[model samples]
Target: MLIGDVSRHSGVSTRMLRHYDALGLVRPTGRTAGGYREYSPEDIRRIFHVESLRSLGLSLKQIGRALDDPSFTPAALVSDLIRWAEDRLARERELLERLRAIDASAPEGWQGVLRIVELMQGLNSASASRRQQAVLSRPEGVPMSVDVLAGAVLTEPDPHVAGALRWALARAGGDGVAALAAGVRSADVDVRRRAVRAIAEMPEAPDATAALADVLGDPDATVRGHAALALGGRGVTSAVPVLVGMVVEGTGDVEAAEVLGALSRDPGCADRIVTALADELAAHTEDSAVRIRLTQALVELPGTTAADLLRELTHDDDRAVALIASAFVGVLDRRSTEDRDG
Candidate 1:
């Protein structure tokens, strides 16, 4: 076939076919009487092969080698092509995400766009200090999306940066509770802990509390501790049991004790707190350390409930427990006496 016929049939441009001939990748082995380039059946088939390989992302040079080199196999080269394509795809996706984030920021100008990009970079910064500064240096008059802050909070590893992110998320609040709630369900123990801590700052009380309540029984003690503390701080009486368990186990016992004490201020919650703590102490009667922690937790209670518990602990079997309880009882007595005198 002539070059035009070959081009028309194979869909390969004559210009490209001539270039391919020049490169010796696919050369016609015949000529017409008029001296125009003519392609043999074998050459036409080779053109189809070259086009076929090109579709697989092979460069012209690679395709040349593949069609010639008996030792060359498609497997290794195809794998490399797949990897290259995957990397390109990942880059494209990331660019798309950045564009979406910038668009979502609704930047008013180039400066605003740059600032949003900078903030996004900062949130993903490897240095905790940079992330901290990024959150702290949030420019006034520029609104950052709550999703950005929430995402940073969920993954932030440094305590200071994480705290700042949490603060930003709370201030930027709108649908932030959802992100942090998802973090609470993370399988990573640390991520779950951070998620709950960050969620604790979210003011979407109903949603945040619901998410927190879901994780209250997490097997990771730290995760449970964070959830319990958050709920207790919010005065949720349902946290009473977790807080009591925290006190008995001595994990975040002091904070738990303080929250328990605060919750006990409510006449309704007071009896429950007192009863839970007392029951734990009694149930673990042989555990001196448990009893000690339980005794200290009692001091947070008011209206004589803690003092009454302390009095009972004063004559307990463990001498250390008795001494500690007696000392607290003395302090309570002095405070009680002074209150009456005043």
Candidate 2:
């Protein structure tokens, strides 16, 4: 087949085919008697492989090596590809997260803010009263009372009403904490679960740290998961052990993976984080959101371990992971070049 035939069949432009030839990525098998380049069926196969890898975000040099190396296994090539993909996905997710934060904090009219504040206060007062009643009535065991309250708080007719309830729970004092802590023992799963979420956000509360640590052992996975989230938000290093334990025990649980990923962000937890990812114990179990979080956390690690793991992840089965790894590689490469110049 001629170069044009290979280009048409491979979906690579003629110029790109020439460029690949120049880079030794998919060179023709030989030249015809008339001085035209002739690509064999094998060359066409290589052309398609090169095109596929290029589409996957491998650099020309990387693609060339992949083509030249007969010893490179499919898994090895895919692994390389995953690193590139993971980096790209990480960059996109970071941008998206920043956008979300901006949207959430966007300026609103004074009237709107005031209305939101009023709704929050009212909701908080109502929730506190209900919680106090539950505490007084059920002191030892409440069937579904906590669940009922949680349902009311989360499913409130208005967004402002829900936000208000959250704000009020966040601001509750000693009595509020005690009531919530007691509620965690409620027989109603929903009640215990919601209470855990509310309590996690009370980072400034006197006993918030201890309360969060206690809930880490909640029988309900949702409660335990929320506690992990709260620990991250509170930046409480005390929760690291519990979180890591969760990672080890719940290696296949997506929620546990999310928490482990978050824990990896703290500078103090870098070693543990890298160990977890490198081991690939809980790494592949991560859901899309957790994978994004993991990529971000991995990017924060300072050593070659992080880079190597990321490079490995570039060929992950998950496309999102691969994209993020690619973006990370780009960032690392840029930083490396910058340091060399400096």
Candidate 3:
């Protein structure tokens, strides 16, 4: 086939074909008598294979070496990739261990207690962790060591480990729920925060929303923030009003702003976000970050009201905030002018 034909068939431009050929990555099968390049069906197949390898994060030079080496087997490449992944996991585990040790020696605080839990969970395998979770679910006749492990796991720093505990709690049925509820009530703020996060990821059962909502009132600001974030992740739209209330009433808490920003992405929550932003801007004059974020959140929604708010924010008192707002307004204006011209 001609170069044009190869380009059309492979969805790669003609220029790229010449570049690949120059690099000796994918050479055409033969040259025509008139000196034009010609590619065979086999050449196209080789191109596809090269592209596949490139997609797997292999550089052109590495790919060239691999193609040149006849001893390279698919199994060997796969094993290499697996080893890389294992190395990454090892590094993560090491970091978690160090954090855990620090938390252990530190004075009794939410961060320290939570770190211990996170450390224990990280050390256990999925199967062993699941078994510990099972014991937590039962809470009765379980060994003291298992119970202690369960408590520790609940405070595990890794969200994945906490998620496993929540899964076990759900599977344990009524008894598990009771134990999980106890975790939420722990004096250690980190345990409560992790519990809220874990429960948010799990399937919403009876009283789950109410229980999470209660955490929004926890004395610790971090606990309230996690609860808000968890509720957002769970898509608990029923909590929109409560989230709006927090954004307005929970001044000095950036977490509420984050939750409101998340909720603003949903059309159902757009109006509440607009109202909250308006109220916040009016009540707190120095909160430029909130104003900027609020403007951004509003622009993501569809409707004239949000557009109007963005326009007004473009001239806000805060220079940084005004710049962001102006940029969005400029984009909309340009688009509108382009539509008119077209």
> For residues 1-342, what per-residue lDDT tens digits would candidate 1 score against the true structure?
999999999999999999999999998998889999999989989999999999989999999999999999989998999999999999998788788777766778898888878898887778989999999898775677666677777777788998998888877746777757668778888888888888777756458888888888899988888888888888888888899989988899999999988888899999888888888988998899999899898887997776788899899999989999999988888998999999
What candidate 1 gets wrong by more than 4 Å, as runs, is 1-19, 34-41, 204-206
What's every prediction's RMSD, in angstroms?
2.7, 30.1, 25.6
| Collision count of model 1 | 0
Query: What TM-score does each of the candidates earn?
Result: 0.88, 0.43, 0.47
Cα deviation of 158 in candidate 2 (Å)? 6.7
What's the residue-level lDDT of 213 in candidate 3?
Answer: 81
Better of 1 and 2 by TM-score: 1
- lDDT per residue, candidate 2, 196-259, as tens digits? 7666666777776787788777777667767776775566655555554454455324454555
**lDDT score at residue 183, model 1, on the 0-100 scale:** 80
The lDDT per prediction is 0.86, 0.63, 0.66
Tens-digit per-residue lDDT, 1-342, candidate 3: 988998898888999889989999999989999988999999998888888887876778778878888886667776787788789889998677656544434526665455445534544545655644443443443222223334545656655555656555455344333446877899987877766665665454566667778877788766666666667656666555555555545542455556555666777777766776677677667877666656655555555667788888878888987899899888877877898999
Which stretches of model 3 miss by more than 4 angstroms? 1-152, 155-160, 167-176, 233-269, 331-342
Question: Deviation in angstroms for 252 in model 3?
Answer: 13
C-alpha-based local distance difference test score of model 2: 0.63
TM-score of 2: 0.43
202 in model 1: Cα distance from truth in Å? Answer: 2.6
Question: Higher lDDT: candidate 1 or 2?
Answer: 1
